[model samples]
Target: MIAGLTWLVGFQLLGELVVRVLDLPVPGPVVGMLLLFAYLRLRRYDDSGSIVIAGSGLLRHLQLFFIPAGVGVVAFASVLGRDVLPVTVAVLGSWFLGLVVVGWTAVGLERLLGRPRDDLGDPPAEAAA
Candidate 1:
């Protein structure tokens, strides 16, 4: 358990480093989790490796991970109840708007770069042939 906690902290720091350097939009800890997940997936283990066995314990007690969050929910019940809809709307609306902006930016970028949008157009390189 102590080792796992240390590992988590180290990974989190590593994530912050990458996020800061890359200027990623997502949170650092989220990037760390993605890095850890990618590492776990890439690990080559022997057939008799115990990684699976070790992971089973964490999976079994996954609900325990949410205990602190549950406590927060209880402690803030009144505040949550009072502003739930506003909070939900703000978060959801921001996420939707972000998606829209990102989509539009991508389309604008593709057009600016002159990438062919469809098969109906001859390849730009071939047009000079």
Candidate 2:
């Protein structure tokens, strides 16, 4: 367990170092995650599955990671309240736009693939008795 934890933090540190050294626009954790993914992919099932086991153990505690963010939100409750309208608008607008884009894309793909509109429906019900 300790060794697995080390592996996770070690990669994150390595990522942080790279980001700082290169002045990367991307986040260090993102880089670290990418590195870990590649490493796992390259050596899947290596180390008698210790790495996978360790990773899964850590994932089980993932919800704890949100505690700090929740605290920060609580700390800045006033600021959030002040900007609630704009924040709400931005969030709602993005959601609406995303759904519209997805719907359009699905329709476009279906048309491109030549699926008939009726195929999108449930099976026809038996005629009313």
Candidate 3:
């Protein structure tokens, strides 16, 4: 577990270093995750690998990671309240846009792949009834 955690942190640090040096616009953690994914793909580690075990352990307690974000929101409550209208509009607008884009993409992919929508298995018994 320690080794796995170390590897994870090491990759993150390496990512940070690369980003800083290259003046990247992306977050360091995102780059680190991509690097880790590439490494895993090339190395082909099994489920029992230390990295996988550590990652699973972290995922099991994923909710704990949200604490900081919650605290930040509370700290910025006043600011958020002042900009609530814009924030709400931005959030809802983005959500609607994403939904439309994803729906269109799914339909496009389905057509491109020659997969008919009706071929999706039978509906639930309750729905059929």
Candidate 4:
């Protein structure tokens, strides 16, 4: 577990260094995750690997990670209240946009895969017959 944690942190630090040196617009953590993914793919690590075990352990307690975000929200409650309208609009807009995009993508994939729609179990003419 210690080794796994060390690897994770090491990759994150390496990512941070690369981002800083390259002056990247992307987040260091995101880059680190990509790097980790590539490394895992190249090495073909199995599920029983130390890193996987550590990652699973972290995921099991994922809610604990949100404590800081929750605290931040409470700390900035006044700021959030002040801009509730814009925040609400932005949140709702993004949600609706995501829904529409997901729906479209699903439909596109269904057509591409030549899958029959669940609703259309039988053709209209066949149903009438």
Candidate 5:
């Protein structure tokens, strides 16, 4: 039990270190999750033991941890309401823009390589002899 708690704290600390040192926009736990994913991929440590079981249990209850943050949001709902329209427009536009941009980028590169799928065909070639 003590070991499991220490492991959890260690991973969380490592995650916080990466976020604080690199100044990532995302939260420490998110960064830590990415790092943990990478570590799991690299190390190939797949076992149903303390780490996985404990982490899964914590994640299963993660929603409860956010309740206080949601309460804070409720308290400040009026501030969010005042700018909802513009925020909605900006959020929707940027979300769609990112999707379009990523799709275009992928399609454009695929077309350049003559994939011929997704309507990305190559230039016409001369008839073969």
Candidate 6:
């Protein structure tokens, strides 16, 4: 478990260092996750399953991570209330944009993979016949 924790933190720290040194726009943790993924893909885990154990342990307490955010919202309730409209617009606009991008990506992937297009609402030709 300790080893796995070390591996995770080590990657994150390395990622942070890389980002700072390169002055990249990407978040450190995201880079760290990619590094971890690459490492896991290239190497097999030990029989002790330290990585899985550590990961599950961390996940078990994931809610703790959000406590600060919740507290902040309560702390700044008045400020947030004043900016509610703009915040709502930003959130909804981003969500709609994400949906559009995802739809386009799915269409592109389907064409690239030579898969049949989805026709969820339309009746099949055999059924129509």
After aligning candidate 2 to the native by TM-score, how far in Å is the CA of 78 from where it should be?
Answer: 1.2
Per-residue alpha-carbon lDDT of model 5 for 1-129, expressed as tens digits? 456556777877899998899888888877777777787788876776566777777788889998988898778878876789999899999999999999899989988998847353654566332
Using TM-score as the measure, name the better of candidate 3 and candidate 5: 3
Best by TM-score: 3
Q: What would the TM-scores of all predictions be?
A: 0.44, 0.68, 0.79, 0.75, 0.57, 0.70
Per-model clash counts, in order, read 0, 0, 0, 0, 0, 0
lDDT of 1: 0.78
**For candidate 6, lDDT tens digit of each residue in 1-129?**
888899789999989998999999999988998887788778875545777789789989999999989998778878876789999899999999999999999999989999948679778899989
Cα lDDT for residue 73, candidate 3: 79
Task: Give the alpha carbon lDDT tens digit for every residue of 37-72 in model 3.
Answer: 999999998899989999889889989999988899
Which sections of candidate 2 miss by over 4 Å? Answer: 46-48, 99-129
Model 6 ranges off by over 4 Å:
46-48, 115-129
RMSD of each: 10.4, 5.6, 3.0, 5.5, 8.2, 4.8
Which window of ten consecutive residues has the lowest lDDT sum in model 2? 120-129
Candidate 5: minimum summed lDDT over ten consecutive residues — where?
120-129
Question: What is each predicted model's overall lDDT from 0 to 1?
Answer: 0.78, 0.86, 0.91, 0.90, 0.79, 0.87
For model 4, the superposed segments whose C-alpha errors exceed 4 Å read: 81-83, 106-110, 113-129
What value does the lDDT take at residue 67 in candidate 5? 93
Model 1 lowest lDDT segment of ten: 45-54
TM-score of model number 2: 0.68
The C-alpha local distance difference test score for the whole of candidate 6 amounts to: 0.87
Choose 2 or 4, whichever is better by TM-score: 4
CA shift at 13, candidate 4, in angstroms? 0.9
